[model samples]
Target: MVIKSSMRRSVRILLVGDRGVGKTSLILSLVSEEFPEDVPSKAEEITIPADVTPEQVPTHIVDYSAAEQSEESLCEEMQRAHVICVVYSVDDEDTLDRVTTRWLPLVRDCCSDCRVPVILVGNKVDLVDYSTIDAVYAIMEDFPEVESCIECSAKTLKNISEMFYYAQKAVLHPTLPLYVIDQQDLTEGCKKALKRIFKICDVDNDGILNDAELNAFQRLCFNAPLQPQVLEDVKAVVQRNCPDGIAADGITLTGFLFLHCLFIQRGRNETTWTVLRKFGYNDSLQMSRDYLHPSIRIPAGCTTELSHKGHQFVSSLFERYDKDKDGALSPKEIDNLFSSCPAPLWGPDFHRTVTTNAHGWITLNGFICQWVLVTLLDLSRALEYFAYLGYNTSEKDNQLSAIQVTREKRLDLAKKQSSRNVYQCHVIGPQNSGKSMFCRSFIGHTLEKTFAPELAGNPQCTVNVVQVYGQEKYLVLRDIDVRNVSDPLLPAEVQCDVACLVYDVSNPKSFEYSARIYLKYFVESKIPVLIVANKNDQEEVSQEYLLQPSDFCSRHKLPPPHPFSASNKIKRDVFVKLATMAAFPRFHAAWILFYKTRHMKQLGFLRGDSVVWWKAGLGLAAATAIGLFVVKVLKTDKS
Candidate 1:
């Protein structure tokens, strides 16, 4: 039994049994999850029990077993056992006979042949004959050491709770408080997430739930929801925060709550659960318990800090992996480094044409190697050679297959962080280069009409100013007002990462102006300005003005500038990628997943005309092969 309440006291429990008697199963069922050890492995939620009163302690049954124990050791096990469970099966006559012959001697060694409060568990009830249940109960009647042993089953749950009740009579108070906490202070997001947690466990969003949500969330997110006692401990606090007639229409949840509910509905990676299990931290429960106790005044603030740190760590890892100047690694390269699980050198899978058992199960060495691969990303650089296709294979074959199954989750998390974090970027070019037009595109308006039909020198000119933002509570694409200024504008006002100077590639004069501007802002002072030569469609802008990218970088004495087009075939998606990269430089790791998915999208476009071209090539090969086959047949016929 375990106890903790508004009263602030602690409860302790002890369980003891012979090893291999299904003790671990009972404890795992009670505390861990009912997750099956098969198929797309799950993370079942563990619910804390609702509170039991002071007089009635909350009964938490944990069945502990030691496989090898001496008589003295068995005696020591029962010292702290206020409630003992001498478990046996109704179907196993020999094991039942041993309850008197082999088992009670161990109990007697501990407590000198005295009767203890206990329940006789007839495990595997699903596999037993019901007729023997009475005979099993009769066996306990002769043993004074067995106080109230019922012939109950563990698997079919036959009288399981009743058995616990019998055991709890020696321990628990039946009328314990159901909830504890001041509900008024809960955040809407927390409340909403919690309500969904309740729905998952309770199976309906009826404002109260436990146990079942644990199972559902486990199936979906590969993570268990809150435990039952944990919910009970905070129930009052939830009610206070979600007061009646507050955001309810007659009764309705607020918009904020709706979004939070969406968060609950979100998917989770099945693979992550595998990794968590391997690490022995299968759920967030053990991790969050000591960190978020009621004694802490600002409980949520700590959680916020932790989340921020995790986001930063993820971003930092991304930055490290994006090796090429391009914002993202090609899918093949990423999968080589982070996508696949590595087999160990000790196994048959380690070398070419090796041994596996006739049964298809690997030897001990092979088994260990495969089992060690809990997650795909655990593969390091040394093992990358085996991941990609041979040189004969084309780039189209590349895939970050490790992430194919869970890319949605990884991308979702990255998006959340990018939206929340502030980063820097810039644009560059010269006069009449549509610099202002491009910048305005970020805010979704255009000065194209304002720049057209110039009357005088530098007519309708608006440049030399940077947009400074402290913090945007809204998205960047919102139509915000802009103010332009004269030359030598101080970027300190904007505090941006870089600046932009646009020049018309069609106009030689404009290109000259663009060059001079780059020298002033970036070349001399080295303040990082990106030069944009616009008007690629116009014949006036010659091909020479379109830098081979590398030469442009050389000429500018800076890294090559990523191309931007107000109009182009691939401009939209390319720009989105560039914009994401520029906005979040720390998003280095995500770039690989980004481009892999991008390239994967191309598979949908390989149809119609492309298919005809491939078919034509195939037809030629088939014709040649048929011609050779006819020649051989004619030769055979003549012979």
Candidate 2:
């Protein structure tokens, strides 16, 4: 489909020049389709309907005559006009000289801020026996705003219709933003936009557009596929002009840029503009605001996550960019993956924020987990990157299809089960409570690894994939620091899917901080709570609080504090337990049943109602047995 011009309702063309330059004759001839013997000082304004115009936009023609309108009125008209037609009598050399000295300067002074386009119209060409096209070309060079020069005869009606058409085209499909006439190349903005488009179309991340990729691009922009012969011809032309444009596999980025430059050089600005607008760029060579941040209303209590289609797209992207098939993206490969974006979405601390392999590269699971974190925290930014990454190429599909807005959190809690694949756990504790270490450990970082000079920054959040009941779920651990026990936690800090109250067991005063935080925040809320006594490798001290750690948990009817030590061997079982609690927030029995029945259902052991009832009874018995074992272990730790 043909992309329409920018969202302009109408185009206003104003005629300005010296007297007797046939400005009046041009308008009168266009309206009447014939030369008029008697012409007024200036013709009234004319409005052309959108259906009759090639641009499908309403056109308004205004006439300026020195004898009829004042200079102030002329300035006003110039400011209002989208494009100016500076008329000069082709046979009168003196009139053409006045064009640069008087008319062009006047436009520049009046419309300095707007930079309105100018169409140089040399009228009454019938009287000129010799060609003056060369002179007009020199004028265009001097005035960069001059879009095009047309020579016409108002009396014979020669090129009369074409003159106004050029004027309208100048305003709608402009070349100024896309081309540089003096340098004979594309403008920087145009090049940047096209480079992004090229990267998006390079599906394999090999920095080349193969035949299939090229055909997909054509179909996306023009709604038609290229014939095999035509595709080869395109490459042949590029190869002939640019030696390095073609690669062994397909057309390189250099070739793609050269093709666009060639199109603009051949006066095919519409061709380049078509591709740009189809990719969500406006006439200004910037992604349109509406396209970047489409209107998506997320009601209160709702959270956003990637839809199935979104997950599939990003997973495919990961597989494509993993050139070595090593199941992880190196630093260079990560750069190639986000080359189409304005900049890398993550920062130097990204490795600390997600699950990276021992090589310090982001693993596929970490990549997906990071995307899920962004969708939950900032949905608009996720949508913007989706546009940059070419997630939606067709007008029928949009970035909205890539996002899924969940029902209200209240509804999920009421149902006693969440359909979300991601859960956020806020780790709240006082300063130096080993909170950061606990959060980092969620992504597999040990105490020594967290202290690495490269991981020096204080990244408050970390995410990684965890298995709960044989299903993969992302768990985001946010390290929320409390300056003092007296300082209150913000409402946003108090809200989360799960709350982890961490305290340094070696610090005598640490247990009080965790206790106050839990009583202040999670005691009344439905959010699941987990108490962790960190730094267990050090000698355990009696907390200087009214109630010891075990007694505090018992009084609150919360689970016994889980012992942990970042200095000890890394353990993933604690993370799995936390994720399981998050998955089933309402009841402990449900967690046990979910974990126990997963394999049974997979094995088709619960196919009949009688078998399901029998299994459910077994599940309850097992849950009770596990509960007694956990209590026994807690009592042993307390003693």
Candidate 1 at residue 459, lDDT?
Answer: 15
Enumerate residue pairs that collide in model 2: none
**Cα lDDT of all candidates, in order?**
0.37, 0.83
Score every model by TM-score. Answer: 0.24, 0.89
Candidate 2 off by > 4 Å: 1-5, 394-396, 452-457, 588-639
Q: Ten consecutive residues with minimal summed lDDT in candidate 1?
A: 386-395
User: What is the number of backbone collisions in each predicted candidate, taken in the order shown?
Assistant: 43, 0
lDDT for model 1 comes to 0.37
Poorest 10 consecutive residues by lDDT, candidate 2: 595-604
